[model samples]
Structures are given as structure tokens and as C-alpha cells.
Target: MRFLVTGTAGFIGFHLAQRLLREGHQVVGIDNFSTYYDPQLKEDRNTILETYPAFSVERLSLENAPALNAAWKRHQPDVVVHLAAQAGVRYSIEHPQAYISSNIVGTFNVLEAARQHGVKHLLAASTSSAYGANLEMPFRETDKAVHPMTLYAATKSATELMAHSYAHLFGVPTTFFRFFTVYGPWGRPDMALFKFANAMLKDDPIEVYGEGRMSRDFTYVDDLVEAITRLVLVIPSERPPVEGDTLSPVAPFRLVNIGGGKPSPLMDYIEELEKALGKPAIKTFLPMQDGDVPNTTASPALLQRLTGYKPETPIGVGVPAFVDWFRQRYDL
Candidate 1:
């Protein structure tokens, strides 16, 4: 099958595209190489993907509707996985326009392209942050995600609603999966794992937010990608298949939470990193910043029910793997 994957140079997108190519699927990737992080990292990822015979890429932002439309016309992809967005909750606080343009406007273009191009399945990325301020443990797909703590989560929540409208109106099959704190090799620098690993390697003090009280369902990158690949084939339908199935009665749309089903404390995660690096980090505990939730956990029951798969990697295994990659990548 031919797949059009946005943000192909990004952390999750790159891994997903590479996996698809390994399975003998044709992949058309698009990435603007935004300066959100270092563009060199994105370029490096694209370099490896370029070596694949079945992989091709376009350099453009999702906000460019005309360009995105043209690419859709050219590729006519069988599946559209929209993953591009201005990520980072704290970053969104400083630059709200970035979130509006990239998340809202960019996603709108993707939805229109998918609708017009007649793609079979459209899987877009959402976040556990969407469960903003909800005190519920093991957040379910059916839980109300009304109170988004940050502009970033609000934009993502908006995308989910927008996707539902398009799917209902155009009879498009769509899956909006909310991801918990995902981390692994080739991860984003802004993420805690990356920052902590780098700081520890340099013997610098790592900032501990929420006084080491915050918790997250840290999903492994490979596990998240595997769940997505499986969901590619498990398209939703209007008719419900099982109990508590999130299949929309009005449209072929659903929401699934992808994570390890385990929440780890921030301090514990840092300790795991320290173990991986075989070094101690200068710890500086601080208060939680604005637009930040105290904890995020996912109930993988829905994902497992649909795909018979669940994210099983623990921090002990995943953190060390990332440290190893970090050392090799930076020659630390």
C-alpha cells in the first residue's frame, strides 16, 4: 500500500515511515524541517530514509494548503497519517500563534486533502494532554477532554472534533489516537528524556519540575509505532463491534489511547536515566510550571481490545536504549 505520512522527519513520523518501508510499502513523506528543534536532526533522519528505494519526500509545511493539495494530487496515497504539528506544551505558551497555524490551520488542510483524495484510512495524532485537568486515572477514550490546560492540548482537542465532523460529513474512516508521554531513540530534544540524558552526560544540573511529583505514562517509541501500524488495518465502522468501543454512531470515527498502561514518577524516570548513563545528575527540584498537568496515565484496554497488542516496554529498558542512542549519535 502507498502511504502519505506528514512530519516524516519527526520523531514518531520518521520511525513510522521507516517501518512501513521495511514492510515493502511505498511511502511519500512531507516535512517542512521547522526550526521548532534543530533542523539538522530532521535532516539527519531524512538522510537515512532517503536511502530506501520506496521512500520519497516533499519539503513543505502543512499550513501551505496549495502545496499540500498538490502533493495529495500527485501521490493519491492509499492511507494518510497526519502527524505534523507544533508540538511541546510549554513552547505553546510562549508562541500561541505557532499552535494556531500549525495545529489548527495545518490540520484543517490535512483533513481537506484526505477528504478530497479519498484515502482509505486517516489516522491523526492527538495527545494524553487532551485529557487536560481530568483527575481520572487510566483515562479512557470516552472520557470528556474538555478542559485543556495548555494551548497545545486545546489545539489537539480541536483537531479531534474537526476530524469527527469531516468523517461524519464525508463518510471518511478516521482514528484519532491520543499518545501518552512517548520517548525513545531519535526523540525530541525538548522531551525530558533527551534533555536529562544530555545534561547528565555533560555533568550539568537537570531541572526537576513539580518537585519530582509529576507522573506520565511514558510510552516507548517502538511500541507506539507498532500500535499505529496495527491500527492501520483495524479501521473503525459506524456499527459498534464490542462493548465500550468508541466507534462513533454518527461516523466511522474513534479515539484510542496508546501507551504502556503504566505511569512513572518524574523522579523515578530521572533515576532510571542516571542508571543508564552510569552517572549522577545534579538535581534542582522546582515547582510545576503553568500549562502543565500533574499526571497522565492511559488505559490501554481499548488499544489492546482492537489490536491485541499493548505497549510493554518499561522505563528501565527504554531509557537505557535512548541513552545508548544518544551516546552514539553525539559521540558522548
Candidate 2:
């Protein structure tokens, strides 16, 4: 299979592209290497991918439609995975325009490219944050996600709507997967696991938000990649819908939650990190910031029904793997 995956330099994209390359598939990666976190880390990931003969990359942003279309025309990929976006809830509070441009305009371009190129299947990344203010435990894909708390969540939800419209009008098959709190090696710096590990290593206090009462369905990167890999073959159609499926009634589009349906407490996650790092973290309990949800848990019924798999990596194994990678990468 030939795959064109955006944000190949990002954490999940890197892992997904690497998995595809290992399976002997040709992958054309697209990344602008934005300094959202550390460009050096992005470069390191790209450098590793460059060694694979079946992998190639284009240095461009998804907001650039001309360049993106050019890449699509050049590669003529069989599948498209859109993952690039301006991520981070707290960051969106200060820089709202960035979210609009990257998440909105960027995803718009990807949808256009996929529509024009007649790709077989299109897979894009959404977030669990879309289930904002619903107060619904174990969010399902069919639940009402009308109230988004932040600009970031709003943009992601908008992406889902736009993709649905395209799938309806243009006959493009699309699958939008809402991710839980994903954590693992090569994770984003803005994520909780990375922040806690970094702060603990430096002997700094880790900020415990929501007054230490938050919980999340933390999915490991490898598990996410596996689910996505299997889902690439489960393209949506007008056939009968599976039980608990979120398939659109009018279009060949679907929404699936890629999680384990297991919500772990925030304090328990920190404890796992402490155990992995062999040190206790100095904790600073604080109120939950605006646009922050107290808890999020995904119902993985649809994902399992479609892919026959679920994200099952527990924190005990995942946290230690990340800690080991952090130590070797930074020599701490």
C-alpha cells in the first residue's frame, strides 16, 4: 500500500509511518517541522524514517494547499492519514488564530486533496476533547458533541463536520478517530506524562491539575498505531452498520474511538511515573484551567467492532517505557 501521512515528524505520525515502512509499504510523509515543541525532536524522528528505503518526506505545511495538492498529485497515494494540527488546550487560549489556521484550514486542504485525488480511504485524527461539557461518562462516538469548551476542540469538531460534508457530496470515504490521552515514548512535551517526567527529572514540582481528581483513558502509541493500521482496511460503506457503530446515515463516513475504555486516575498515572523514575515528584495541586475537562473516558466498542482490537496498554508498562526512553535520550 502507498500511504501519504501528514505530520510524519510528530509523535503519532512518526510511529505510524515507521510501522507502515516496516511492513514494506511505500510512505510519503509531509511535515512542516513547526517549532510547536522541539524541532530537534522532529528532525530526530524524520532522520530515523529517512533510513527506510520505502519512506520519503515533503517539508511542507497542510495549510499550504498548493504544495499539499502537488504532493498528492505526485504520489497518488492509495490512502491518506491527516494528523497535523496545532495541538494543546492551554496553548489555544493565547493563540487562537493558530488553531483556526492549522486545524481548520489545514484539515480543509487535506480533505480537498483527498477528494480531488480519488483516494481509496481517508483517515484523520480527532480528539476526545470534542466531548466537551457533555458530562457524559465513557463518551460514545454517536453522543452529542455540540458543546466544545476550547477553540482547539471546536476546530477538531469542525474538521469532523467538514469531512462528513465532503464524504457526502464527493463520495469520499472518511474515518475520523477520536483519541484518548495517548502517552508513550517520543510523546509530545505538552502532554501530562512528558511534563511530569521532565519536571521530576529536574527536581521541579509537577502541577497536578483539577485538584488531583481527573482521570483519562490513556492509550499507548503502539496500540493506537495497531488500531489505525487495522482500521485502514475497514473502509466505511453503505452496508449494514455494526452494533454501537457511528456510521453516518447519508454518507460513507464513520467515527471511531481508539481507546481501551479504561479510565485511570491522574494520581495513579503520576505514581506509575514515580515508580518508573525511581523518585517521588514534588506535587503542586491546582485548579483545572479553562478549556480543561475534569475527566475523559472513551467507549471503545465501535473500534473493537470494526477492527477486532482495542488499546489495552496499561500505564504501568507504558510509563516505564517512556521513562527509559527519556533517560537514554537526555542522558539523565
Candidate 3:
């Protein structure tokens, strides 16, 4: 299968591209290499993908609709996986415009390109944050994601609606998967695992948000990528499907949750990191900021019904693997 994947340099995108290439699929990728964290890390990830003969990378941003469409038109992919976005919860607070441009406008461009190209399947990334302001445990795809606490989440949810509209009107098969806390090796530096590892290794302070009173699903990158890889082939054909409790019924689209199914406490995650690095972190307590959810748990029943798989990486095991990579990468 031929695939056009956005954000190939990103955490999940890089892994997904590599896996597709390893499985002998042709992939065309796009990334602006923005310094959301470190451009070097993005470049390093790109290097791995460029080694494959079936892979090609185009340095571009989704904000530029013409350029983005040109890339998509030239690639002529059978399936389109839109993973690129300005991803961060706290950062969304200070830079709300970034979310609007990348998450909203960028997604609009992807959907437009996919719609125009008549792609068979269109898969895009959404985040657990979309289940904002809801105190529901194990958030299901059928749950109402109308209340987004952050601009980032709102944009993603809007993207879902946007995609559904296209699917309903134009007969495009679209799948939106709301991802939980994704962590693993070759991960983004801005995430908790990477930042905490750096701080703990250098004896710096690791700020505990809400004094470590949060819980996250913490889906590992490998498992998340697997779910995505499998989803690329399982396109939703039925329009307005029925889901338990919640789901869209007018469009040929459904939002599925990709997670490990367990919400581990923030303190327990920190402890796992400590054990992995063999160093206790210097902690500083901080109050919860705006646009922050205290806990998130994913209900993967619909995802399993579609893909027959779910993320199951425990932090205890994933932490050590990541710490080892951090030690090898930075010589910590």
C-alpha cells in the first residue's frame, strides 16, 4: 500500500513510517522540522526513515495549503495518515494561536487534500485531551467530547467534526483515533518521561503538576504505532455507526480511543522513572494550570472491535527501556 503520512519526524509519525517501510509499503512523508522541542531529534528520526528505499521525506508545513496539497497530489497515496499537529497540553495555554494554525488549519488542509485526491482511507491523530472537562472513567468513543478544556483539544475535536462532514458529504472513509499519553524510546523531549529523565539525570528539579495528583493512560509508542498501522487497512465503510452510549450517527466516521486501558497515577510514573534511571528525582510541587485534566482513562472496546488490538505497555517496563536510550543518546 502507498501512504502519505504527515509529521514523519514526530514521535508517533516516525515510528509509524518506519514500521510501514519495514513492512514494504511505499510512504511519502512531510514535516516542517519546527523547533517544538529539538529539531535535531526530528532530524535523527528522519534519518532512520530516509534509509528505506520506499520512503521519501518532504520538508513542509501543513499551514501552507498549496504546498501541502502539491505534496499529497504528487504522492497519490492510497491511504492518508495525518499525525502532524502542535502537540502539548501546557504549551497550548501560552501559545493558543499555534494550536489554531497547526491543529485547525493544518487539519483542514489535510482533509481538503484527502477529499480532493479521493483517497480510500483517511486516518488522523486525536488526543485524549479531547475528552476534556469530563470526569468519565475509561472514556469511550461514544462519549460526548463537546467540552474541551484546552485550545489544542478543541482544535482536534473540531478536526474530527470537520472530517466527519467530508465523509458524510463526499463519501470519504475517515477514522479518528484519540490517543492517550504516548511514551517510549525516540519520544519527544517535551513529554513528562523525557523531561523528568533529563532533570533527574542532571540533578535538576522535576516539577510535579498538581503535586502529582494526576493519572494518565501512558500508552507506549510501539503499541500506539501498532494500533495505527493496523487501522490504516481497516477503513470504516458504514455511515453513522452505533456505539455504546455515544457516537456520531450521520457520518461514515467514528472516533476510537487508543490507550493501555489503565490510568496509572503520576507519582507511580515518576517512581518508575526513578527506578529506571537509578536516581531519585528532586521534586517541586505545582498547582494545576489552566486547560489541564486531572486524569484520563481510555475505553478501547470500539478500537478492539475494529482492530482486534490495544496498547498494553506498562510504565514499569517502558520506563527502563526509555532510560536506557536516554543514557545512550545523551551519555547521561
List runs of model 3 lying over 4 Å from the truth.
238-248
**Please, what are the lDDT tens digits per residue for candidate 3 over residues 1-332?**
99999999998999999999999999999999999899999999999899999999989999999998888878899988999999998898899999999999999988888778889889999988999988978887777789999888898899988998998888788889899998888999888899999888789999999878998898988999999988777767843343452334666676788997888999999999988888788999999878888999999887786777988888888889888888999976
Question: Which residue segments of model 2 deviate by more than 4 Å?
Answer: none
Q: What TM-score do all the candidates reach, one by one?
A: 0.99, 0.99, 0.96
Tell me model 2's lDDT, rounded to 2 decimals: 0.93
**Could you give candidate 1's per-residue lDDT for residues 131-182 as a string of tens digits?**
9899979899889889999999999999999999999999889999999999
Q: Rate the local accuracy (lDDT) of all candidates.
A: 0.93, 0.93, 0.87
Q: Candidate 1, TM-score vs. the true structure?
A: 0.99
Worst 10 residues of 2 by lDDT: 237-246
Question: Could you tell me how far off, in angstroms, the CA of residue 319 lies in candidate 2 after the best superposition?
Answer: 0.4
User: Considering TM-score, which of the candidate structures 1 and 3 is the better prediction for this target?
Assistant: 1
